[model samples]
Target: MQVSSLNEVKIYSLSCGKSLPEWLSDRKKRALQKKDVDVRRRIELIQDFEMPTVCTTIKVSKDGQYILATGTYKPRVRCYDTYQLSLKFERCLDSEVVTFEILSDDYSKIVFLHNDRYIEFHSQSGFYYKTRIPKFGRDFSYHYPSCDLYFVGASSEVYRLNLEQGRYLNPLQTDAAENNVCDINSVHGLFATGTIEGRVECWDPRTRNRVGLLDCALNSVTADSEINSLPTISALKFNGALTMAVGTTTGQGKIFTSLEPEHDLNDVCLYPNSGMLLTANETPKMGIYYIPFSKPVLSSSLNQSLPPAFL
Candidate 1:
């Protein structure tokens, strides 16, 4: 989507702790105030970094305070301060970092996945523990505040790992066939998995069962070649307790409210606490999008009546 001006973009600052209702009412007031202001500014270019190796995974912390990134060919993980946009620290690992996770509840510890094992390291103390697993997975999401428990997606199955016990609790079942899980995300007590066939499923971690599902595949007969080939999901995330977003390998993506896709997306990061969405991608050019949530429509009757998928 092309943005005509910065005025077309609205970023509501919800940093101060406010209830959803209060936040929405405040946003509506602001929108009414800016409705006629014909001011526009060019989008400013931010700092850019040239990586030495292929950056495989990138994620922002739950509180949106820090950013954690790693590469496939490198054995090191880097931490960046979000506000300053400066490098904070880096730590080398024993093996190549396939994928890594920063616990939202506790950013002090991080977990990394190697060939067939996982390693846990403290932000300050360094390597604390490691475990050998039976299967390898692409992504992992923490189980609430339990630093030692998390979920891993491998193929079509989701495995719950008890880090303290060094064993899996039970495998969660998915309905998709030959569902090779490509990516996984967890937030707001919900777990979501994206598959190679371009489908997404949001599950309830407590029940270890599917709560909602989304089929992101384009209409085959009406889609062009590019749309048809872009069916493998490379990334996925939930915007808040309601909306969800997914990015595909073909450099395409979508944002969803309920089962119907609403907006095109790229590499997306949803901040539930802050009510903001950040999207980035590498295509003809590299760019980043910052979208702030307006609390006014968030609780609208139409939105509330949409579906469980939207909820």
Candidate 2:
């Protein structure tokens, strides 16, 4: 979708013509309103969030009222109002967005990490501030209690950017050769990173010390395979509790609960409330699995019947 640059934030308003109401009868007005509602419902059912090019990352706000996503070919961030089932606004960016985080429930504040090591901050009005990291970042997590942004990349050290102080603090050191993704536990404030060596390291942000380590490759290996053959981590997420979900480049995902292997796994997301797991891969459809302690069950693919508009 075409969007204005940071300097050209636009305001959209709706106004009524003086004779518009008188021109339509009450029955016709009701029919038009009903048609509008039906169209909106169809769009919501299809979940038609689109981008001109490939979508890099997507996130839902804390309140579950908005969705923030980034797309390429002239990078842009689009915010959608889920409650209204419409695009709220979109802003063009200079660099491709690697990953992004929503900093507020209302989505007034957002942070975008670019591929060129640049970190940008945007407010509700427009571009707010920006900075750069020393290395190309893969993923980042925000620790709400300390207001610290932890960024991980293809290096052992995790860069800490203090949003409150607006400066870089000492980096968190790791023994792993490279870090691919990071997340913070909302329930207990534990910082976790998924390394390229197929290990998940847990840390305590308060003490800046490594508390635990999980060798995912070892746990996932079959009797015939070796640990060194597993691929690097491609996705990682925390369930706000003890469980952490890890996905590998080869489409293998391991969590407190396990899932059958697929192909070219892209990302994994968990819905604790519904005891469900959603996985996106290199295919046109997504996978939904029922999360069970014993062998998890593959529910279905997201290839459902669509309205004619989608066709």
Candidate 3:
């Protein structure tokens, strides 16, 4: 997906308008103030994988070489090389997997969520360790790579997991809700967590603290008034360069930017623009959230007005 001019967010000629669902047409039309946002998809695949199991969650790694897919059907975590789009490794877990990730820059190690009850960290060959979190968890993220600490967004509160001690530590509590944590996405210094509610939260990894929060209620706020209600965030990704793509379970998406400094690498031919943040929903039933968007999150004064995925 080609990002438009400097700091501008033009939905790359992605899927056509007919791709959006019928229910979203009126609500989407009224929300996006502009006329149809022209999108031309260079590549398109409607139904991706064939499985008796449905997708639990999808993720890309820090090094950007692999796509980690985890799900039910006596669920297992499978790793796939990004460019080759071929299966790299598949570990058959005794239980259904809810979330999975490749934590190393070399993609040497794996971390995963099992039944949202157990946390497992394994070597490439699946010879590794497992931790049964005391509380139930929906999703998890590893921060401060050198350390064994992981941010666990449980159904109620967020707990810090230390692999060194193999238990919970420094548990900073949230409101009284256990089934809140929906998805967790992290970059190097920062991370974001989504909930079953309309809230998307940001955090500081160093201090294990909350930074800020955004209410994505579809009807809360619009250009003039609130547009849509709280959107159910399905996926969250930190696509390096300090930007995140927030995918909702509903047929929609959003880009969250990082307020950080940029480097002037005059030595290279690379045109430094804002980071790339792209996401998608089931509207088109793509079953993949790896769509590309090179535009930076904060680089835009450009209000996003794009065509629906399936019209």
Name the best candidate (by lDDT).
2
Per-model lDDT: 0.51, 0.67, 0.49
Candidate 3 stretches greater than 4 Å from native: 1-53, 82-85, 145-154, 176-188, 222-311
Using Cα atoms with residue i matched to residue i, what is each candidate's TM-score against the true structure?
A: 0.58, 0.70, 0.56
Question: lDDT by residue for model 2 over 114-169, one digit each (tens)?
Answer: 99999999988989888999988999999999899999997899999998887899
Q: State the TM-score for model 1.
A: 0.58
The lDDT ranking, best first, is 2, 1, 3
What's the CA error at residue 227 for candidate 1, in Å? 4.2
Residue-level lDDT for 141 in candidate 2 = 91
lDDT of 1 by residue, 212-269 (tens): 7777656221344454454666655454466554555564422223111122322344
Lowest summed lDDT window (length 10), candidate 2: 302-311
Better of 2 and 3 by lDDT: 2
User: If candidate 3 were superposed on the true structure by all CA atoms, what would the RMSD be?
Assistant: 13.0
Ranking by TM-score: 2, 1, 3
Query: For all the candidates, what are their Cα RMSDs to the real structure?
Result: 11.8, 12.4, 13.0
* The best candidate in terms of TM-score: 2
